[model samples]
Target chain A: MLFFEGSEKKIEVVLQPGQPSLRQLEREYWQQVVAKANATILSSVHNEECDAYLLSESSLFVWEDRFLMLTCGTTTLMDAVVSFLEQFPADSLAMLSYQRKNEYQSHLQKSSFEQDVTALQQQIEGVGYQLGYLDGHHNYIYHLDRPYQPREDDATLELLMYHINGDTAQYLRSDNQTLEGIRQRLNWEALLPGFLLDDFLFEPFGYSMNAIKGDRYATMHITPQENSSYVSFETNLEGEAAALVLNALLKTLQPDSYDLISFNQQLQLDHQPGIICVDQATQPLSCGYTMRFSHYLKPPSAERSADRLSL
Target chain B: MLFFEGSEKKIEVVLQPGQPSLRQLEREYWQQVVAKANATILSSVHNEECDAYLLSESSLFVWEDRFLMLTCGTTTLMDAVVSFLEQFPADSLAMLSYQRKNEYQSHLQKSSFEQDVTALQQQIEGVGYQLGYLDGHHNYIYHLDRPYQPREDDATLELLMYHINGDTAQYLRSDNQTLEGIRQRLNWEALLPGFLLDDFLFEPFGYSMNAIKGDRYATMHITPQENSSYVSFETNLEGEAAALVLNALLKTLQPDSYDLISFNQQLQLDHQPGIICVDQATQPLSCGYTMRFSHYLKPPSAERSADRLSL
Candidate 1:
């Protein structure tokens, strides 16, 4: 029988073939397994306990001087648990001793809530997210109805990729193996750009995860400027406007085809109107026309009569 | 014989194509020539004169405008006079008012010797060429040597090379036609190191005739740290020691020849010797050899002393 820990509670065990009941199994055998698993969790949690707090109930539990907590879950839940355990292990509990009890609890609650909010926000904001406020405050509080859809494989890959070096290509070429082997040859600078160099840390390409297929070719799409205006409306209003224009342009043009879009005061051609894109290039757009508006006119005699009546 | 002005006195002449008497030339012709030359000299003197003083030629004579005279060697004197006259037209003397003085002997005797000494002192100290001192107090001093240097044909082009754009390649590529042409082709950033952007004002390349040249290519002999203990005598001794060792190593190996000198310490090989010869790379040397020094051992006595000192 195996027990799994979930976000809120412990999962009930469903006995498997050849597995003994709790009474039949030797106490020492279970104790040893629990101790070994706890040690593993402790070691992993050393530096990153803040990120690993969720894993506390999943990998091990506190029982007297020691703790034993382990459970099973859906593959997605398992991956999340594993990742959390990996980043923040049981050993991280030592670091917690230095933190004030109230402060630590508050910090843990705030971070956990933030993680949940971020996950929810990202899901709700997909494609087209409304830009409005419920009250006077500028709070972009996301609607909780659209729960975050976690991709287990992507989550796992992202976790692994975070630790993988950028120059893993060299090792991959040498070994001709996929996954773990490539991960073992990580350089801290290549794996974590910002950690090594302050300038590269915030760059779009710095935190990108390479997509891998089982027994197939790996593909990587670098978001060189991932936070560009087109990706999210949550960015600056000017950026949002720019993104809107780009999205419209991308929709109008077919991929792998090239065309020059000239914009003037009036549409020169009938087929497709060229949109006026913002100037991101070094050179100013030539033949650009400024849009002008005028109010409808009335007769000079009627205007004079209206002015005289007002006076 | 053409009359050419020498440094001290004007050379008067009559072009006879044979031996001619010095006094054979008509007084009016001599006066005409003298008037024309004197007008040019006076104009040049005004342009060159930064300041002036009113002084009596003698107690018998009323106080009038007096030129603070400059003395020069014959060759320099001729060059100065020629340069001054060449700047203006030949018949410029008719524009100025002239008066003849009857008491030449008395006027010459009353000339201020003290004023001449003061002018010479100011010239030496880089001052007082334009204005004379009144009652031994300093006044406006014109820089005479400043305007003396002759401008070359490519003077503006040279200035554009060393300044405006500072692109040596562009300056070389542009046909020595016009200043604007050179400016259009320049890529200033490529020529100068990014750190030295402010120091660009002080042109390292000699653009002006008086500009000094720096030692662009020099073999700086550096002693190895192990052989020389005195090398570490400076404050921040650790940093100095490392720089000396690295500089020596760079010079010996000439790593710059292969363009491998730009690799940061973390990417560099340990077995590779210390000496590296860099060409234009003037990045301040860093403490790269600290890790390498760990492999080497200090003498036993020195180690013991270090331990004792620590206690």
Candidate 2:
């Protein structure tokens, strides 16, 4: 199978008070926006507080006053961001943040992080910083420089796992795998808990899901290709709830390395026997939110047969 | 120290029969060409058969009727190629070959391999092929498709080593190291016996050298940074002569992994006790030249403390 760029481009924006509620926008309109990035909205689900789209590439979430859209592959995410920005007045965006994680094969990408930031700067003023090392698991973050107060409840946690191991990863690559089988394998009842869920199993090998409960949302995307397996779990859940989910996934996936990124949340990962922190950075974003990034890896000395997959 | 982009871009071309000899070109002219790529020609050495230039970024060698230029860093080697192509008559080129190895940090580069191929195609018609997996160590090759015969002696071998280890690596990285000290550390008298060598040692860390014996040439470039230590050895010698040099360097460097690329040469690498071939590919180009690429690694199970450096 051809290698897919599993790393994602993310854009999150909180609209000004006078702006129209993004949730009022129709599904067709959102589809058009997704299409700009060369991706189609496969399906979507809604709850009282949000609409979650399962895209051909990744996912999109829209709330009353804020929205988050994420995409992978060679999708021109900047095109979608530029299109969305053009629809509203420049001043309509109260707080905006753009983030990109380093990809496995960056040469296949159409635009670099610098190019994306350049495109975003044309529409709005922002500050950009790179966290971690360029040659390793790192991230590029850009946020609006204007002063704006963030909601106390606004928080997000992202867990990106790489080189997944064990029977679950093998099961994911095997044939005869069903959506229900994957759900049971993931044990969402224990991990996600009390949430309306929607997910899809891609042909060949891959998986994606979106869940919503009350005003909080969570999404997961899994790429099980042997050479570059990656799984990303993201949520607005906070504190112990988020930590429990993260720990459960770690136990199930058994990734060789993983990165944890949190926005407006102070996340503390307890020391695991074999796992070690490789690098980390904490930055106060200009958009009135604090961002923390940490990369942890199972050292080769502690490696098991399953965790020794070559990258 | 900043992580220098160790991967290189290489271009080789043969001029038509009636064209002016490139050797007649003055150092000032070649300096201008190198300048276009944002690199300075540090020093140069010349034998009766060729003029070898040790560039700040990489190396360049000019022969009577042909020339080869290889550059690293974020240098725009395409700009230099375009400038050189513009100087000659469109039909004055008999054969041209351009090759680029997959870089460790391609996002930091100014142009992709495809972009370079497009730029080359603008000057002359050619065929291109990718030799290995994009997510792994690979090479992109483009050569003129026009009818032309290669010299019986025209052969090149490239040994690209990664994650070098042991005393040599530590010595290279240590402060207060001098050119004579590095030369002795590399044991040029043993590795490159009977050859006249010109070498340079970078201020903080790094080493480069050019050697010539009669008409044949060999060059070595080393980047000794902790995160991405790399050493490349290339020569125009054939068969056992090339293999001997390759084995000697491999013994000294003790790289965790390496790639062997040869043009117009059939290289046979004897199995070492712990090293194994992970992936390989062989392709015949339209220019009537055969190319072979092989990637070898010392698996983690056999890893020594020296070979266990994190990539």
Candidate 3:
């Protein structure tokens, strides 16, 4: 059972447009922080004033004001988070959402081997972290202080990660299919229309592409190693286009199996996303693509007001 | 994406029970050969005269006079194969159906860093080898010499491998349920009655179990690491009972999505086992387990007589 992680640790930092470092010198400071984590910025793009950096492990997106940083493998993201805050003391940090898949914990701990999560938990003071499987698919998620403003009308964006069939890896390693041919077959450009996309391929076996339109952007990274193979599709847009993007991504990846992990920041307290398995989703819907299971990661309750105040 | 291989080099040696070193002192000599492959016999069985050794990565089954050995990981299984032939020079070697998943090739090359498969291929004289994907899942299988006897009424047995959904991994690693509880809930005893099963739990993570009922047997291996999680169900039995055992195993595993890789060694030219996917199998069938894809590997035809005679 091969499973791929979209990101080992994803930190969502939201800030108002007025912050001094938000617009100026953001790249220089954050690049150093990325270096601190021993990861390389393979490629980057600028759409209007916003930018996206496709890192060796994960991804980083910068809007006009907000910034999203995600890292996989052995990147010391927690330590980098400490560096980011120090370099750019926010006028006011609205919310910080930090999440990591359970398997990548070993990678993170490679450098910080002497210290476990308890010590990292101490590093994350006021912000409370919940560590457990999210969306009920063995993928673990960790959230920090007031990760999202739960809203009645919020239709949260979803990040889908597919464990592509081993054929992708075999193709990458072999010269059977050119990268352009693959992109065309997958409808990569059509999926994320209207953008000058930046794409890159790792020397050994990996593929990545990122694009941005105004402040809304999408990016995909594929690790094609037999031991670590996964195709990740992510976007920050909403409404009808978002659903289209998810479906397009699925069709493009053509994963033998996939797990859809969505963190709905704003779900109505009473609304429940019905649990859908692989069989149910494949019936009337698209090809073999199926939803494994879907559920809120324990909806934030009004009874937890005290918990929010602690932050 | 993570894919697991339970074999690097598998040697299927069929010898008559009258050989010089057929049964007694068989283990002492073979243990040295296994040691050369850098694997240990984790747990095994001694049913009267038959024996089965579950290796660290693969398996070895010795029933009556038929010896089957398979190795995965960075084990030098090819080198061990040569030593095996030297140690037990059989009066007449009926057949050798050696196979390996593609990923394990790199592991075999690790020990004899300077030499490659071409060298080993040359060394394996009198035995023609064919390398390609078996049952079409990107798992390369190598066959040594003539493997099967094609017949008019040959109803060959097939052992299938599926990539289960990730939830099974979470369940295995969970502290929510104990192993005993899981066994009871799975109806473990009913699946294989009348056998003293030997089971072992790999500390901090994995689980494995093997049982021998006379000459017939069943074994399960679970590598529950979140990144590389899979539950493989394999049994060498046939008929309606085999189908029942498969359903029972699927229910016990309850994988969200799985791919069935089967290799039916012998079969009547006109007999075709239906390809059962997620929809057809899971309809009235028990549990939430669903199949991904099933297909017959293009069988080697009688037209390839020259290829057969090349050996």
Candidate 4:
């Protein structure tokens, strides 16, 4: 037997010699205390581990399986396994360490295996096959049924000359060796319809027209006396298409005029002289009988102010 | 009479009205033909009433002498005369024609003749005065001594400033305001003296120096062991004079190892162990050495290959 003293009173307590005390028994106790404590600790640790797993699961899914195997040498694998064990409860220390070692080994084997599979899949597809699939399945198709046709043979050349002028035909055919080659050479300026200058349609009588082969329209050399001449249309088009289009275009563009006398009379007026008349009943004519006889003058205001000579 | 027959050797002569016969003889022929023909046509025209001299002499001179009783005008006198002529040369001709008629009646007596004589003489002398003459004497003195002494009050702002700066008394009184103002306002980066920093002088120890304004130099926070410091000359006159006159100035600039340590200590170097030297022999001895070491060690070569690392 052994005797123990209390702190507040000198009370004696008896115990078996060499036996464990009640305080030591609390530490050694394994019935419900040890198990309950372990369960609480493990549940909290497991919850934390679950939270970390949810947070990083997508990242792990993307790279963990492949990257882990790449860095899995002896020391690196050991470090991963140890980190895995540290996330488990201390109560389940043995089982968690064993499970972590197995997981590390499995990751290494799976990463190595996937590399071989990926290479095999690439070989099976081959180059250019995917590109052909994309082109056939998903591109637009443009079909030009009436392709541009050009004349290379003598007969075709003759037909072209019959439609266009001889000069135009000569220009088109001089550079091209084949019918397709001549067709490719058709420029925007050379493609105008032949009806533009056809004499039977738009005959230039009072007015004159000059035809130029290239892009720009020919210039006209109309004198001030010939200003009464105008562009006339003979088309069968209707409504605004006939008058509005022609008038609007005429308003913007000017008919070119040059001095024919300066050009040594190479250009000439095709029409008769433009005439202007004055009546005898005007203010100046009423002042004198002699003014009434002056109506036949070529220039009416010749005797008036010098400024009046402009007209 | 002389006569000749058709069948025989005979001759006949008949007189005609306007014929030169021997009866219209020697004295009359010499007077009409020889003497008149011998006279020069120019001298005969000069003797005539309608002489070329009537047109050649300026009508202006004739009118002034006959009507105004004045001599030819001077340059100032001509100004008003020319202005009148410019408006009316024909009117001036008419006036001169009237004057010519008056000159023919020069003997006419007049009551105001003395007064007219005095006025004409005075006008003539007035004209002579502007022509640089006085009485009968020529005044050699012409333009004033100082033709134009422009007033200082009329000077432009820039010219005033130039005058102020040029005057030594004004410059010293203002302590060279113009130079100081210009230096402060100008963009000195473009105009800074070349080779100035490179030539900063180091004193006795032969250490290198780099001089810069306090505003231009960057503040560097360095550890005590790695302090890199410089001595600054702060006086305005010293700085300006140094910039203007110094040559091979680096010889006077001194930067020692001791200065660097003191600067680093002031920057709290003890807190930054990484910057301090741990090993004696391998440690950098100077600021330049430390800078080179830092540059070499930076970012620690990412490439695994030794050849790429060297690059």
The per-model lDDT (C-alpha) reads: 0.19, 0.82, 0.49, 0.17
Model 2, A1-311: lDDT tens digits are: 34677889999988999888899988888999999999998888889999999999999999999899899988988899999999974699898888898887787788987788888889998877766543346787888889888889889999998878899999998998999999999999888888989999999989999999988999999998875788999999999998888888888888877899888998776535677665577787767887887777654442111111111
- Model 3: per-residue Cα lDDT over B1-311, one tens digit each: 23344324556665544665455655877687778778888878778745778777666767655677766556777677667667555334544444443331232135422132344454442332211111012232333333334223212233333333334445676756566755664456877777556666665655666666776666666755443355555555555545666676555554433334333422122212322232111111011111112322211122111000000
lDDT of 4 by residue, A1-311 (tens): 01110000000011223323323322223112222211111110111111100110000001111111111111222223233224322222211101011111122232222232233233221111000001000001111111122122101000000011133233332433333433233321233232122111111211112222221121111111121222211122223322332233222222221011000011112211221111111011111110000000011111111110010
State in Å the error of residue B145, model 1.
Answer: 29
Q: DockQ of candidate 3?
A: 0.03
Model 1: C-alpha RMSD to truth?
Answer: 34.5
Q: How close is candidate 2 to the true structure, as a TM-score?
A: 0.65
State which candidate, 2 or 4, has the greater DockQ: 2
Query: What shift in Å separates residue A54 of candidate 4 from its native position after superposition?
Result: 76
Which wins on DockQ, candidate 1 or candidate 3? 3
Q: Model 1, clash count?
A: 26
Q: How many angstroms is residue B229 displaced in model 3 relative to the true structure, after the best TM-score fit?
A: 9.9
lDDT of 1: 0.19
Model 2 lDDT on a 0 to 1 scale: 0.82
Show where candidate 4 strays beyond 4 Å.
A1-258, A261-268, A271-304, A307-311, B1-49, B52-311
A218: Cα error in model 3, Å: 2.9
Candidate 1's C-alpha runs over 4 A off are A1-212, A215-217, A223-311, B1-251, B256-311
State the fnat of candidate 3 relative to the true structure.
Answer: 0.00
How do all models score by TM-score? Answer: 0.13, 0.65, 0.54, 0.12
Off by over 4 Å in 2: A270-273, A301-311, B1-6, B9-43, B46-51, B55-57, B60-69, B73-311
